[model samples]
Target: MTASVVLKFPVFTVTEFRPLDRQIPKNHPSNSVKTYLPLKTPRFPRQVKARTTLMEAAQSGSSVNTSTNASMKLLFVEMGVGYDQHGQDITAAAMRACRDAISSNSIPAFRRGSIPGVTFGQMKLQIKLGVPHSLQQSLDIRRVKSVFPYGEIVKFEVVDGGMICSSGVLVEEMGDKNDDCYIVNAAVYVGY
Candidate 1:
C-alpha cells in the first residue's frame, strides 16, 4: 500500500467603515463656494446740470453769476479772405486770411480772470480755414500756426471751399502777381 498526505488553506475578507462628516473651515483655499462684497459706482459733476440751473435762473428773472461760470462764450466771429497769385503761396494767403479774421475784433476775454478755472494761457482758438483744393498740399501748417502771437491752443481745419480770383496785377513790390490767386477764408474762435 502507498503513503497518502492531506493539506488545508485559510481565507480572509476586508470590510470598509462609513465615511465621517466634518465641517470645512472658512479660510480653506480649496473651498469651491465663495462670497464677495458689493462695489459702488463713481459719480462725476456734469456741465448740463449747471446749465439747467442757469436756465432756471433766467426763467425766474434772477441775476446769474456770469463771471465765475465755466461755460464758454462765443466772443466774436471774423471772416477774412487772402490771395497769393505769384507763387500760389497758400501759407501767405492763410496768414493774411487769419489776419483779416482778427483785424476787426479784439479779444479781451483773455484778460479777464472772472471765469473760473480759465486763464490767459488757456485761451482756446478754433480756426476754420477754407482753401482751394489745388493749394491744400502747398500750404504749410506750421506757418499758418505762427500767425497767432498770443499763447493759444489753435485747432486748424482746412476745407475745400473758397474763391480763386483771376489776377491781372503784376508781381508788383514782391506781392502776388494775380496770375493764380489762392483764396483762404478763416473763422477764429477764442475762449477759455
Candidate 2:
C-alpha cells in the first residue's frame, strides 16, 4: 500500500502537538526539564482538506499548479534582500530564486474567460525589497504584501491575433548608500 503526504510548517503540522501532563524526576538535566513524556496527540485523520495554496496567504502568493496533464504553466517571481542596520548585502537569495523561476519552464497565468477584443493575456511580475532584514523577523515574507497605500492587481488582456509579442523592462533602485545594504528587485513574465 502507498500513502500520500502533504507538509506545511511552523504550526499544527504533522509534528506539532501540545504536551500531556506527566510526572518527571526532580533532578532533570536542564533547569526547565520537567520530564520526557508523550504529548496529548490526536488521531491521524483518515481524510483532510486537499486544496493546494489556499490555506494561508503565503501559499496563495507562491502557489503553483502541479498537474502534469495540462500543457499550460503558471509561474510567480520573488526577489528581496536582507539588510543589516549597517545596510550591507546580508543575502541575495531572493534575486536568485526569482531569476530561476522566470528562466525556468514556468510561465505566467492567463485570463480564464474571454473578452470581446482579447484572445490571450500577458503578465509581468516583480518583487521589490523596501525594508532591511533587521526588521524582517516581524514580517511574513512568504505572504503577499501590498507596500502601496491601496491594493494593486496587474491586469492581463489576451488580444486577438497575438502570434508574436515583445516586452521590455528596466529594474533599478537607490537607497541609503552609506548604509551599503542589499535591496533585491526581481521581474517575471508568464505565458503558456
lDDT accuracy of residue 131 in candidate 2 = 35
Worst 10 residues of 2 by lDDT: 158-167
Give per-residue CA lDDT, model 2, range 33-151, as digits (tens). Answer: 23233356978868786766623533355545442112323343333222222323223333333344344443212344332332344333333433343533433443323331221
Pairs that clash in candidate 1: none
Instruction: Output the lDDT of residue 176, model 1.
Output: 49
List per-prediction Cα lDDT, in the order shown. 0.67, 0.34
| TM-score for each of the candidates | 0.55, 0.23
Instruction: State the lDDT of candidate 1 residue by residue for 20-107, as single tens digits.
Output: 3655576766343222332347666765443546557656756456433234443445688877767668889899998888877766
Candidate 2 residue 74 C-alpha distance from true site, Å: 4.6
